[model samples]
Target: MVVAVLLGSVRSDRVGERVAKWVIAELESRGHEAVLVDPMTLKLPLLDRMWKEVKNEKGSEHAELKAKLQPLAELYQRADGFAIVTAEYNHSAPPALVNLIDYFLEEYFYRPSAIVCYSATPFGGVRAAVQLRSLLAEVGMGSIPTLQPVPAAGDALSAEGVPLTQQLAEKSGKFFDEFEWYMRALAAERKRGTPTGTAA
Candidate 1:
């Protein structure tokens, strides 16, 4: 199975990269294909009127957004599941992730997604996870109920851009287990032409 990781932090602290790499490694160790989807690596604007124009005007190009979209959507179409690792900004996920998720609708449908949220404060932006789960379901993605939240996150992060506790390592295993259950179930339900719960 292929698992695509959507990393949410844009900080140079490398929190997103670190978490993505580790998660991909863990997934790979278990014989699954895990990939990191870094928003930073792609040339995307924070807010571009281009995307707004393209969707409205016939034959207009979403050149800026398409660079990221075409590639990601292709990968997304083939993936079995996804892991979105993001740091909260002002009690919510980064705007980058919000936009990224919004760019595509149907490509993410009928797939499993899990969240790994972190923040400087307590609860590790678990509240955002709730809202994020809502959004994922709205976009036709099945969200895994089990999630990882690293609280007091700044204290646990070192200067070299590493997590101090690595608590997410353990949670990832459980997340993957649930993903397997949900992915298999969703595939079966699709074939059976029956709908299941929005959240798994």
Candidate 2:
């Protein structure tokens, strides 16, 4: 399955990048296509209008923005599932992640999402994952039941996102297993028939 790994943090010294690297590596190791959707690199303008709204506008600025977003929209449309990597800020998911995801609606319908939460603290940003579950459901990619939370994210994985400890390496199996199951099930269903508001 092709899983878009949405890297949620864009801070200058963000550790979430390392966490995202681990998530991507894990997905690839499981034989899934891992596409990194970094908010920092995407540089999407804040949510004045959603992708669909801008897609219909005719002004020069809107045209340019549509060009920028069109490929991303197609990417989301083709993706089998999503891995949402996030950090907690004030006990909520990061704004960059929310903004990037909020730009598309139908592209996400019927696809599954896996919440991979991490933090510098021992709590592991699970608070952010809690909020993300609801947000992801609203966008139509409801999260899988098993959440993969990396506590003390900096120490859990190396700078390159290689697992430093045996425990961290072993913990990922079930998470990916469940994610793949849902991805395949929902994808097959979608192929049989498109959901309302989603493009086939």
Candidate 3:
């Protein structure tokens, strides 16, 4: 399966990139194709309207908006599943991540997403993960039950983006196992044209 590892933080000196690199390596080791999708690279504008709304509008402005969003749309369409690497900002997800998510709808339909939450604090961005779960569900992606929370993430990872200890490795392994299962199952179901009741 093709999984998109979404780096959800775009702040300067953000550590989410380290977590995303680790996730990509883990997924690739399991024989899955993983793509790194950093919002910083995408540079999507803050969302003000849905695609449908833009399409309905009869003006060059709407056309321009569609053109701008095309790359993001195509990228998301290629992925069978997602690994969302997030950091907590005020007990919630970063505004940029939410904006990126809100830009597309059908691309997320019936897909499975795994939340990888990290933090410098002890709670490990679990609060942000909780909020993201509901947001992803609204976008039609089924979130896997197993969450990968990297507590004291800065200390947990090496400079090379590798997990530093055996304990962290074991925990990440379990998370990957569960995520892969859901990814394959959901991708198969989608391919079979199963009526998931969540398609847009």
What's the TM for model 1? 0.78
Q: Which residue pairs collide in model 3, if any?
A: none
Which scores greater on lDDT, model 1 or model 3?
A: 3
For all predictions, the C-alpha RMSD in Å is: 4.4, 1.5, 2.5
Scored against the true structure, residue 79 in model 3 reaches a CA lDDT of 83
CA shift of 58, model 3, Å: 9.0
Q: How many backbone clashes does candidate 3 have?
A: 0
lDDT of 2 by residue, 76-187 (tens): 8889999999998989999999999999998888999999998888898999999889999998899999999999988998889988878788877998899999999998
In candidate 3, position 166 carries an lDDT of 74
- Largest TM-score belongs to which candidate? 2
Q: Model 3 over residues 133-152: C-alpha lDDT tens digits?
A: 99999998868998889988
Q: List the candidates' TM-scores in order.
A: 0.78, 0.95, 0.89
TM-score of 3: 0.89
lDDT by residue for model 1 (1-200), tens: 77888888767764556556666776777788887787778646765543334444544366556655667777887777778887877767788887777666666777788887777777877877877888888887868989877676666555443556757534446777887788777766655653553422
- How many residue pairs clash per model? 0, 0, 0
